[model samples]
Each structure stands twice: as C-alpha cells, then as structure tokens.
Target: MAINILLTDTSSPLGIGLRNKFESTTFRFVAEHPAELSWRDESQVREYLAEVKPHLVLNTIGWGEGTAIKPDLLADGAECLGRCLAGSSASVLHLSSYRIFHGEGKVSHTEADVPKAASDLSKAFAQAESAILGALPSSLVLRSSWVLSTEGGSLLARLLADFEAGRSTVISEHWRGTPVMVSDVVRAVYAVTQQIIYGANNWGVMHFGSSDVCSESVFAHKIQDMVQAETGRLLQLEAIETETDNSAVLEVRRLRDCFGLQPRSWRQGLRPAVRRWLDRRGLLAEVDSAVVEND
Candidate 1:
C-alpha cells in the first residue's frame, strides 16, 4: 500500500532535491510549511488525521534564520504536533541537531549521553526531545552533524560570502564534522519513516551522518583548492575555533550496523556544495575573484 504521510518542512531550501531524492520514492506525502498551520488549522489537521488516518507524520519544521523569532517556538510547535498526533499510529521522526551538546571531552555520545545543551535554542530542542521521548515513546530521534544542504546557507554559504567579498576567509582549523549532505540525511529519514529499516519499534535516540571526520581547516583547504583548480583563485584556511564539540561527533555505530548506511564521502558532498554556492553567487565565472591567497 502507498503509505499516506504528512510532512512539515518550513525550512526547506533544498526544494525538489528533497522531494525528488526521497519523498517521491516513499510515502504519498502532504508537505506543508510553518505558515500553513494554526490552532484552527491544527484542528483541521486533526480532523484530517482522523478522517485520512495517515500512516505517518514527518516534521522537519525548524527555524535557524528568519524573523527575529524564538527558537523555542519551533520546539514547542513540534511537541504540540506530536501530542496532537499521539496514538494515531502515525509515529514521528524528530530532526534534532548535534549543536545541543556541550563542548566537553571527546565524547562518542550515545542515546544515554547526558543532556548538556549550551544555548537557548539547543536547550529548547533538548526540552522538545524530552517531551517527545517522554510522551510518544515511538518517536525516532536523529541527531545529525553538519548536514549541509547542497543548495543553501551552510558552511558553504558563509565561505562563499567571504570569498566573493575578496576577504581572506579562514576556516576554523579546529572545527570538525562528519558533514552529511542534507540530501543524504533526508533519504535516511525517509527510510526511518517508511520502515525500510527501523520504524516505530526502533526506539531510542540514534546518531546519523556520513562516516568522515575532517577538521574545518582541512575542509576549507580542500574546498579552496577545488575552487581554485576549477577557476584559479586561492582561498586560505586559518586555524580557528568551531563552537561544535565532541558530543556532536555522534556515536553513529547504531545506525551503521542497523541500516548498513554507507554515507557518501564528505569530499563528494562538499564539491557540489561549493559549486552550488559559487553558482548562486554568480562567482562561477569569476572563480579567480572568488578567493584570496591562503596562508
């Protein structure tokens, strides 16, 4: 049977990339953004859920950059949606972040890792996860790292911004990530939802991402060289700090063994991000002007 699913993805910039890469192959999806819902709209949604009896409710709604909005709202809204769909056989896939971890020792965090969220946003999300885990035990929590969109604001955007302005941008040498492409994450999430592997019974928190750990400096150098070789302008990588900590490094062993998920290499993921960013900024033609000498 074609599973009927409703997806909330207000922060979707990867557009058809998401729909094409995953959604089309899986559930019969009814996707909506944040603006599409309301207290009344939720009542309507509940009615629709009761009437349609969807097999799953996938929420990818989040706020990182928009109006001076509170991050707690996203968490709260997600919790509310979870509660509303409670006991409908429509399990949730909460897309949480690795940023929630405190920058402590080299912790290969697991489902049992103590919650040590540092910032307000992270705290809010942590709180939301608590609510979901506490209430709907069937929900799946995916803690992801540096999930860069192939076509959006990410490490690539910030780097491209500096590169285009003729400023010598320095990628923090100390910063490191597994850096899963958003497309890959989306595909994995779709699998989690549609029961290709773990479904409602696959309880507990699980880490997900490609299996490549590279420091931000190394990453920057690779991207800079890729751009320069493709165009001939040099970009620099400087030793610096990344707020990201070891907890976010994620003990992805669970996902690896369970799904046999062979994530693409970060190099494969990054070149496209760089190219996309360069193309979006119209710096593709003037790739030489896109950077300064790295030292």
Candidate 2:
C-alpha cells in the first residue's frame, strides 16, 4: 500500500526537492503550495487534511524572507496543523533550522541541548516546532543546517548564477557549518517515513547535516573549485576576514544511531550537483563563450 504523504510548503527548496525525488515512488506525494491555501486558517487545514487522508504529513514550512512566515501565520498555522494532526493517525514531520540554537562556545548542538533562539526568525521557528511537538508527541522534528540545492534560488544556485553573470562577492570566513544537501534531506525523510510506516516507533527530534564542518569561506571556495573543475570556469570569490565567530554545527548521532544512515560530506556531493545545475540551465558552455570573448 502506498503511503499517502501530504506535504505543506511545497514551494520551499526542500519541498521541491522532496517532490522531485519521491513523486514517482510507491509513496503518494501530494503538495499544497502556501499561495494556494491559507495555512493559518484552522478550518481550511482541517478540510484539506480530511480530503487528503495522508498517513504521513511532512510540514516543511519555515520563516523564509518574502514568504509566509509571519508571527501570526507561524502561530496560527502551526497551531492548526498540530491540532488537526493530533486527531488523525497521520504522523507529522516538521522541518526546523539549526539557527534556533544560538548558544556560543558550542561546536555542535545535540538533541539534549535546549534551543536558545536569538533572532526573530529563529524564535518563530522554535515556537512552531514547539507547537507541533506539543500537539503530536510521536512526531519527528529535524534541525537541519545550511540546506543547499542545485535548483531554484538557493544560496548555492544564486552564487553560481552570480558567477555566471561575472559578479564577484565577499564572503565571511568566521561563519561555520556543515551544509547538508537537499537530496540527502529528502533521503533521510524517506528512510524515517519507511520506519514510521513499518511501526519502528522511534519518534523524536533529531539534527541532520553533512559530516564535514567547514567555514562559509571554505564552502564558497569549494563550490568555486567544483564549478571550475566541472566546467573550466574560474569564478572570483573573495573571502572577507571576520573576528566574530558564527558557528552552527549539528550533532547527527541520533540520525546515525536511529536510521543507520550516514550523510556524505559536501565535498562528496558538490561535483554532481554543480554539473546538474550547469546542465539544467545550459550554463556549462558559458565558460567557453567567455573564454572566446576574452581571446
């Protein structure tokens, strides 16, 4: 039997990646775009869930700029989803950001660490996470760091696009994190869903990210190197020195111990992702054109 999966926030990078990967599978992937539905409306959410009858609800919504992450929306929407899912047998999986843990001096935050959200965005995400967990105690929550995708306006894609357009930017060197690929996130979700469907019954919050923790400057340089290696394009990326440290490392022990899945480092995943991005946009040949023009 195909597990009916209802996904909210389909417009997000993670949601889009999930749909691309799992749409053709035995799992029935149904998405609801935020623009198409009023997420804050409790009655509307209830009606939709009743109609979908999803065995698993993957709520990948978040506080992205220019998106629906307003305080009212976050409060009302989370309350609605949590309230609705509480009555149904469907399991909920809420995607969260690692930025929620704003404590200093900690290299990595684990499941045991309490969230100390510093910014408004992190606070909002924390509140939403709490709402879902409070409503559905058996639900799964994931605090993922630096989610990168080959498609869309993700940071990686945007940087590549900028490089293609001959734009040079300064990146801070003090910030550090292990950027997890969107494909890996989707895979992790799939693995957990399988366990949930098969009655594995290990449900709680967990952190997910690549094993390699590097600074933003290092990650930027790595992407530049990968793109150059893949397409012979030399992108200008300057690293600006910073004295203040901004580190976001997540401990993935639970992810490994629980699901038996170990995510690969960004180095292992960058080449194919860059190639795929260049291929999709036909930007692979742009380097050659630039070379010829320069000549």
Candidate 3:
C-alpha cells in the first residue's frame, strides 16, 4: 500500500521540491493550499484531514521561501494541526527555521539548546514548535538554516536576479551561516519519513544543514565565480560590514546519528542550482558547452 502524504502548502519551494522528490515513488502525495482552507480553524483542519485520511502530514507553511503567511498565523495554524492530529495514527513533520537562536558564538546550536527568541519572528517560531510538540509529542520538527532554492524569494534567487539585471550584488561580510539546498532538505525528509513509517519512534526537534559554514560574502562570491565560469559573465560583487549579528549555524549530529545521514557540502549543489536558475530565465544558452558538460 502506498503511504498517503498530505502537504500543507504545495506552492512553497520546499513543497515543490518534495512533490518532485516523491512523485515517482510509491508514496501518494496530496496537497492543500492555504487559500483553500482556514488553517487557524481547528474544525476545518479536522474536516480536511478526515477527508484526506493521510498517514503523514508535511507542514511547509512558515516564514521562509517567500511565504506570505505571518509568523503569528503560522503558530496558530500549527496549533490547529497539532490538535487535529492528536490521538490519531497520523504523523506530522513540521519545517522550522534556525533563526530562533540569537547567540553570537561560533558553536553550532544543538537541539538541546533553548531558542533565544531575540526577535518577534523567532518568538513565533519557538511558539509554533512548542504548540506542535505540546499537542503531538511524537511529531517531528526539523529546523534548518539558510535554505537555498532556485524558486521563490530565496537569497540565491535574489542574488541571481541582481546579477542578471547588471547590478552589483551586495552581501554582508559579518553574517555567517550554513547553506542547505532545498533538494537536500527533501532527501532528509524522505529518509526520516521512511523511518517513521517503519515504526521508528525518534521524534522531536532535529537540525540539518551543509557540513561547512561560510560568511555571506564568501557564499556570494562562490555563486559569482560559478556564473562567471559557466557563462563568461563577470558580475560585480560587493561586501558590506553590518553591525547586526545574523549568523545562524545548526548542529546536525542529532539528525546524523538518528538517521545515519551524513551532511554534504553546499558547494556540491551550487553548479546545478545555478544552472537551473539560469536555464529558467533563458540565460543558459550563453553558457559554454564544455562547462555545461563538465558540470
């Protein structure tokens, strides 16, 4: 029997990536957009779940990937979903962000550390996680940092847009983070879901990201270098120092030990991600054939 998977939002990049990942598999994928139903209303959520009868629910409605859902609303929606799934056989996987930690140290934040919640957004994320875990203790909350995607309002998308428009790509020199490709996230989700389906009781907060870390400027320069090497277009890259400490690093030992998943370098996905972005905009025609073949 195919496992029925219900996706909360199919429009987000993560949702799209998940769809692409599981489409050819035996898992049956179904989705409900935020506009179709009121996520804050528990009754509506219950009705929808009962109608779908999904064995697994993937909650992708959150702050990142250019989602318009507000932070407070996200918390409310999660609360409703958790309540609806309580006492049921269904399992949930909530996607969360690592921005909840506001520490300045170089050490990666672990699942054991409490969220600092320095900003309103972070506070809402913490509240959402609390609501989900409080209602469904067996649920999984996967938090990631610096998710890079070719679609939507991701950081890489914005930088690529700037480079395409012949504008200087200004990046921060102080901010540091571990970038994880959306495809990697989808792979993690599939691996974890398979475990859960097979009766693995590992549930709660887990972090996943690239094994390496770098400053915003360095990551941008890498993208710049790829574009230049592939298309022979030199983009102006500028680094600016910022007083605000926006560094976010996630410790992946918990996820690695639990799922036996090893982290891969973010550079491994750089070329393909850039190629997809450029190909979407009809810019890949200018790319060198040799470089494309090598990539």
RMSD values, in order shown: 5.2, 4.0, 2.5
Each prediction's whole-model lDDT (CA): 0.62, 0.76, 0.80
Instruction: lDDT winner between 2 and 3, please give it.
Output: 3
Clashing residue pairs, candidate 1? 236-294
Candidate 2 lDDT, tens digit per residue, 104-223? 546778888887777676677788888898888678888788788765645576678778788985677777787877888889988887888888777788889898899878888888
Report clashes for each candidate as comma-separated counts. Answer: 1, 0, 0
Ranked by TM-score, top first: 3, 2, 1
**Superposed Cα deviation of residue 63, candidate 2 (Å):** 6.1
Give all TM-scores, in the order shown. 0.81, 0.87, 0.91
lDDT of 3 by residue, 1-295 (tens): 7789888866678878887877767887786444669888888889988988989888876546534436877788888888898898888899998867754344578889887787777788888888888877678899988888876766687789888899987788777778898889999999998898888888899998899988788888888888877667886888787767676778798888888889888898789789877766766644455465587
102-195: candidate 1 lDDT, tens digit per residue: 4544545666676766667668768767766766767777787776653345665556656777777666655566777766777787666656
The regions of model 3 sitting more than 4 angstroms off are 32-35, 66-69, 102-107, 285-295
Looking at candidate 3, the ten consecutive residues that score lowest on lDDT are: 61-70
State the weakest 10-residue window (summed lDDT) of model 2.
Answer: 62-71
Better model by lDDT, 1 or 3?
A: 3
Error of 3 at 180 (Å): 1.0
- Which candidate leads in lDDT? 3
